[model samples]
Target chain A: MTTPTPRANSGPSGTSDAPAVPAVPGPLAALPDADPAARERLHARLVDGAERAGLLDVAYRTLETPVGPLLLAATEEGLVRIAYGVQDHDAVLADLAERVSPRVLRGPARLEQTVRQLDEYFAGRRTRFELPLDLRLSTGFRREVITRLPDIGYGRTESYARMAAAAGSPRAVRAVGTACATNPLPLVLPCHRVVRSDGSAGGYAGGAEAKRTLLTLEAA
Target chain B: MALRPFEEIVTEYGPMVLRVCRAVVGPHDAEDAWSETFLAALRAYPELPEDARIEAWLVTIAHRKAIDVVRADSRRPLAVAEVPEPAVGGSGTGGPGAPAASANGQAQQPPWERDEELWDALKALPRRQRAAVAYHYLAGLPYREIAAVTGVSTDAARRAASDGITSLRRSLPGRTEQRTDAGARQRRAHQREERGERP
Candidate 1:
């Protein structure tokens, strides 16, 4: 606070020399806080500009569902990353930043259909994920294994050994687990359909319970 | 730590950048400067080090964008020659040429738009002084930071902001009017009209 002890007067009309003139807050002291509508308008413009310039490398959002909040991300091409709550959404996003372009955003316009289909699937009304997908996050044998996930069909379960054999390497069953464990597009790519050879739910990146939830939903 | 999603960055610094842009380029071109600044930033944001001072980095980009706006303004055809009559300000008064004045003056004009006297005084300051004032006062950067951002010496940046404030006080109108209850209420209303915050 200003002490209100005016600087000693060196000039006449000492009435003007007293407490408040210099102590008063100046008009320059602050600016009006940013208008929310204006901020939103500007943000929308920024998003559009970034997209136009091909700088929106990734756009994503979180969807609340029976499984948990899924972090769905898309590139300019298609849906690229999906993360379950246990994957530590923040950590998953950070990994995406490291592997994919760091120019990621939470703008979900790119994921509208993805979100809608997911909602329907969770509601047991739809069983297929016929969405454009980006596979840049997976490569080699892991990629090959996940690429065959959708071929298993809805409401059908395949054992890891059988899924591995279908991926053309029967003995690579554990590798199939690794591939599914790292499946970037888990639910959409149908990784939950893979089960243990003994008919038990296998470990899932979304945790075993989430996998059961998906399988049960499919059965329903 | 992994960089946060870019939306958070935009949410955090967008307003400060807008204010800096307005102080340097005027309200007419401030939004454009802000847009360009953010777009450019989003392009280069991936490589930005997390430890860097985000505010200083944003202000730096805003400074460059402000320059671009000023340059673009100077190149406008209307700027080439003064007509016999300049258009009057505020809404419904001018044609398409005055988009900024009319388009942004909807229900209530931004406080910066209403504070025409402050705008004039700020505009009259030398470009460096204006920038220094904005970076220091509005953005709350230190003199050293102003120097780093504007590429001037610490002493010079300090002098520019200090001198800018000195001149601003002398030339500014309506600063000493907060004593009246009506004046206080009016100022608060203008603030609330444009924003929910004083910062």
Candidate 2:
């Protein structure tokens, strides 16, 4: 207690009623240990209620895809962020809390359609993503580049220089690479389609290995 | 600076809120109280003032939810499940809970529901005293904040906590005798009983 407590055991517990508040916090500091199972159950219930009430500012869930575990997050606007394992899921959520809304919570229902589309893409049954996206994190030339990413088409690669030309910045080839490397919605946006001009796989935010995996999966 | 995600708030303060809820509503309904408190917190989290006392804010929400759970519980008196504190320290597993449960055929009690002598003592106190002790001792809220929470004057909050702890010590002084494990103390008290010694 910030206020100095009266001396403990003021002449024992002899006189009942109005003894000093225990001078030390030791008496009750050892509260019962919580059951982890109970915590999880309550947390999930809270998430469900928050989601239904529209208080879940950013709901997220992860999916194990061929590329790796992808962290999908959404706002009331639509799907806002999809981070690769290489991007660090924790840091990605924190960024969303800063860039989107601080009221982030983990509720999978909001991302169900996004997860289905990602699964179909990984399984080779889907060639294009139809999910609504929130790309507010991007701006200016970079935003323009990623906005045009879906035009590259599935299973087809485009030269970075060509992407720059397509994005109305023919000389911004390096900017195109920068945009692709930072594509907040990577696989769904088809940043993987933006390749090195020499027909080789290029640097990717999901790591070069992940880039190879996505390309190989699509090639088959 | 950006406000922290609500999930972090839950992680940091959830257990403490649960403890406060348990003291106010007992274990059986504490989870329900906890769930309701946090759901309400999450709903209004967007507007929570940045300088608000996070713990006190949570305790305030918890205080209200605890009242709701208690009111709902009162309707089902038979289901209130008031297990009496054992006469002396004994394991919850083999303590007086079994005989007591047998009488009600509630022997199949959930593990978490058994043997909280501290909660029992806190439960026995008057409602305001229990809340004052909880928000002050368990949650470490100052009497002014406790006054804000329990709607009492600052001096009254301080009085309620003192009176509450006075009764708590009378009820379970041995529970606080040693800073060591309560289980160890109970087992020692039980072992002393096993030898027919004056415990």
Q: Which candidate is the best by DockQ?
A: 1
lDDT string, candidate 1, A1-220, tens digits: 3322222221112323344322222645445555675576676667666777889999888999999899999999999999999999888877888788778876767899999999998888887888999999999999999999989889999999998899889999999999999999999899899999999998999998899898888888
Which pairs of residues collide in model 1? Answer: none
Query: Which CAPRI category fits model 1?
Result: incorrect
Please list the residue runs of candidate 2 whose C-alpha ends up more than 4 Å from where it truly belongs after superposition: A1-31, B72-112, B116-120, B176-199
Tell me the tens digit of each residue's lDDT in model 2 across B75-100: 96573556432212112222243345
User: Per-prediction DockQ, in order?
Assistant: 0.22, 0.18
The interface RMSD for candidate 2 is: 10.6
lDDT of 2 at B109: 50
lDDT of 2 by residue, A1-220 (tens): 1232333322223222433333323345445545465566667767776766778889988888777888999988888888988889988887888888878887787898998888888889999989888889899999999999888777789999998888878999998899988888888888987888889997999998998998888888
> How much lDDT does candidate 1 score?
0.75
